[model samples]
Target chain A: MARLITWCYKNHWMTLTLLFAPLLLHGQVNCLIYDAASGERIACELSLRAIQYRQGSRNSQLLFDKAIEVGPKFAWAYYEKSVPFFKRGLLAEGVSLINKAIDLEPKNYLYYRAYWYFYNRSYAHCIEDLEELYTVHHESFTNTPGGEMEMRMILAMAYAQSGEVEKGIEWAQHLMDTYKEQPHLKGQYDHHILGVLYYLNNRPLMAAAQLEKQLEVNARLADTHYYLGLINRENTNSTLAQLHFKKAWAKLQGEGGGHSPNIFEGFNVSAQDIEGML
Target chain B: MRPVSYLPLIILLLTFSTFACLQSQANHQPKYKIPIVTHDLSYIPFDPLLDDPNFQICDSTKISSGRNRLQYAAGRNTLRSDIVSRFSPQSAYESFNGYIVIRFLANCKGQTGRYRAASLHLDFSPAQAPSNLEQHAKEVVMGLNNWSRATETNANAEYSKFINLKIKNGKIDHVVL
Candidate 1:
């Protein structure tokens, strides 16, 4: 013990890292994670213990698989193991691994799988996962996997993409009504999402109104400008349309148009697109 | 007599307990050093570049996963949209929706290098897109010229990029930049 203290005293930074690695790696000190393996509403202290040693990396991922072998019921290990596969473009392997997590714990991972379907632009597959979560299970997912966007809003967009625009509008309206009391909706674009759908439905007046409200809250998205431009163009207001198009181009230019994870646009506007509009 | 008998029983218990402690100590492996099996190759697989004969990586040593983009003027969105704008759709009305993932290399000389492409259906089952659609998907990416070279300590570096395109109804619907 004296020798260990001496070594730790010599290597202060390494000691600090060793002392606080888990909090640094995940920032989740609490075991609030759910593991559906036991078919009960319970937090996964077991899963946290399963991965108590390390988190995501080549070594960690292999360790996760070992943890799974040691405890086949450890659903979170499967989920953690699956993540790097998705990053490496092995969707087939990724989904297969996540499926083990989902089957073991649907309450936690259904929306995550749906997000992947959305990421892949498999609207039908996305809709299937979401509908099962909602209709069959009577569960409501408030946000996307990483909590960046609303899952119900994604459901609306999926419905819209699959040629059910009216159904999408209904879903969007429901999402807004259900979550209206919660301010910030976890920093998601509620009015912006609804505005895009409203424009798609040819409700130009409502679309314009909703998008204006969106801009009032958050005025940065290039897609919002692009949608507003399209709405203006449809209303035969060429001047406003061109102005909005220019603004959209400027946002793309100014913001560098980087796509953060879990954020998507209905219309991915380009330089030629803005120029053509102008 | 009773005290002597109790003493022998106590000694047997002490010996048994000490043997158990030694056995546990000898058998114990640190919980933290949980043995990992060799990582399964199928789970990780390989980057698409290794299989393609189209282009050789100009330099592999500096290959980064591209956390920093090679900055272009109009930015990532315009770059992606412009690439799609160059596409003359081959399978116009035929419904082929899913993903077109292209992994391409960028060298230190600000040039796009070798590429590998995969087309998948909505469920992520590999898709047999029309020859032209497949050809153009590869061609449009290979055609990219303007790449700002990655820099490491004020020197040029090489990197690879994943161009993940979301296709809907045989058209490029969204590009994840």
Candidate 2:
């Protein structure tokens, strides 16, 4: 190894290649894992101890408090301490704790804060964090922490929910276009959200086209058929609407449940909802 | 020159490896742990209580019916809308917009009570709304007598639910279940 080092030192090209290796690796790596310093990483272990106790219990929260005190810069401690507060309806306390964590390490904790923002029905705030995470910080996303749906899906859906249906269509369309040829790699119901957005935009032709593609990608997603049925009815195609609604109802009640309910889903057609339509 | 001239380079490469391996190790480990621990030597139990004096959790074991309980939740989304429609115009409160999260329990016989509530701004910071805002929400929630008693393994089961209401311009805009 020493001989190779000497040879590399002798050749400027070899020396330059050796120097660039770390930078090359850095580009390919997800920033969150490598963003922490070794000291903060050790501090996060204290949080692990806290979680071993029952969540939201006195002991667990105390341990989390201790972790925060001992490793004040360790963002995970603040993030961990905020969780129970969020779950138990202490939104202010939860938001304060998570904000500290995000301030310490924005890349890692922004997704979590955005997730609660979505739940709290603060669609604008959710969009702000996600837009920052995606556009400003350039963080690549796969799903929310709960594995419900892609963050892009959340972005597009939030746009629609926030009354920005045009932006929603642009974004959802962009996501589908990116993964169009690769069906398996698409989000669990990316096409469904797009189809719903199209229907909401009053473009029944595009809506029907997206729903047709949705049937091919995720036939089991009952909400897809439910929205498809609504579109068919809107277009005065009662026969197809009836057919789609029946499919939606059957798929909704089937053994596996066409699609397991997701909190982040753009649309969920409940049995009660379908009953009225049927 | 000695081989030690490259020591900094080697150390830099090793440091890079350390950063790469560290959090990925946490990712590989199963995060699931039995979370029902009663005590630990290092534990210092001190959690603030936000509950009515008469309220007590009926079951801790299945308490996490938690997410599953959401499936059987009754009148959450619907009742919230009714409260806004019936009560909003009558009360001349200050214009306020944010969330009101109410945490309470339902007992085995479909009895519900013990409400603890918090109000927050849209960005989720602590904020004050008109007293009537929270009062009206609590009244509607307490008036609800139709909650279904859900039991997975037994007939009598008690549970807790958090009802999050988003208020916009002094009216209940959305109910988050």
Candidate 3:
């Protein structure tokens, strides 16, 4: 009777082990083989890349949701996922996602850089990013060919957009004077900014000439046409103004058959209306 | 009997545990998100006259000069020819006076295929008009037809360059002059 009892106890415990062994192995693999947090972050990054490749906001949102599900702490996923929301004109969601990213990585320059642009709604954030990049690696700006010059131009534009017109103009002029003869930097963004500065200074002819030369080099630039059209319209050259307007319209329509609500509010004349006038 | 009985329970436990772990890990895995970037291209306008089929103009005064009109017609013809030749393949040019009118056709192959002229009215304008005016108009039409056929035959030899021609309301809007 003692031997039977001992055997029975051993058999019962063995049965329990057998019943639970698969669960133990599964838990071990989950803990050891796959790190949930890291996997979620990677998925978020991949989903963002896929969004760019696919050009569909829906796909991006789906991927972003997947990333968040996999890793709730993945800040980059939130940041990347916000892009589609912003693009789809869901500003509220974009703000939330960007805020979430900033919360996760408060000290990260990239997160701050993104927030600065999306929140401030100006080019200042780009300047901030450049400045931060310079701070992190001074040599990247100083030693690299054309890097310093490019950063200066970007800073000038940012300043201009930020309502510091005088400072922007001063920086632009300084760049032009320093790099006037430099083959690599001459006729770059400096010229464009200088043209804008001239227009602001009430020098229409000079502004028109500078913008025209830039347009010649980059015909597809919508902003150049916009400026040129404004100058021409102000000067009472309706034909020239109409030409620029048409060019701008074509470029904007090509983007997706709709004007960018932010930039092209003034020049949103319908094709039929223009034809009627013509 | 004891060893065999124990084997079944061990196998069952291992399989169940593995599945359970997998399910739990799946639940714990975090999700990922993507970032957005926007790239925009600028716009350019296209010429509207290139696609207009009825972009023709006629000059009645020159055609009325009769035999002397040939020189005028010839001059106008040459100018029209030059314009047609210079025009991109996707355009056409037609110029006319009362006594003489010239039409030139350009195709996608960058070849000017046909040149047509009409002088029927030139001989008919006077009370006693020349008998050959009908023949002259006929000749002009024949010449244009022949040229068009030749162009079609040699079209394969030229490089294909496609350009979108803008037409509005079935009319030619602008001439590059």
The numbered model that scores best in lDDT is 2
Instruction: Point to the candidate with the largest DockQ.
Output: 2
Task: Sum up the clashes in candidate 1.
Answer: 0
- Give the Å error, residue B35, model 2: 20
Q: What are the per-residue Cα lDDT tens digits for candidate 2 across A209-238?
A: 887987765587778788888988988999
* lDDT by residue for model 3 (A92-180), tens: 34555665665565443243333324222335454555455444544222211112124445555566666776776676676667554
lDDT of each candidate versus the true structure: 0.65, 0.68, 0.43
The candidates' DockQ values read 0.09, 0.14, 0.01
Q: Rank candidates by DockQ, best first.
A: 2, 1, 3
Pick by lDDT: 2 or 3, better one: 2
Residue A268 Cα positional deviation in candidate 2, in Å, after optimal superposition: 3.1
The RMSD of every model to the true structure, in order and in angstroms, is 16.3, 16.7, 31.1
Q: What tens digits encode model 3's per-residue C-alpha lDDT throughout B53-113?
A: 3322122111111111112223333533443343332212122111222233333333332
Error of 2 at B41 (Å): 20
Strongest candidate by TM-score: 2
For candidate 3, the lDDT comes to 0.43
Clashing pairs in 2: none
DockQ for candidate 1: 0.09
**Clashing pairs in model 1, backbone N/Cα/C closer than 3 A:** none
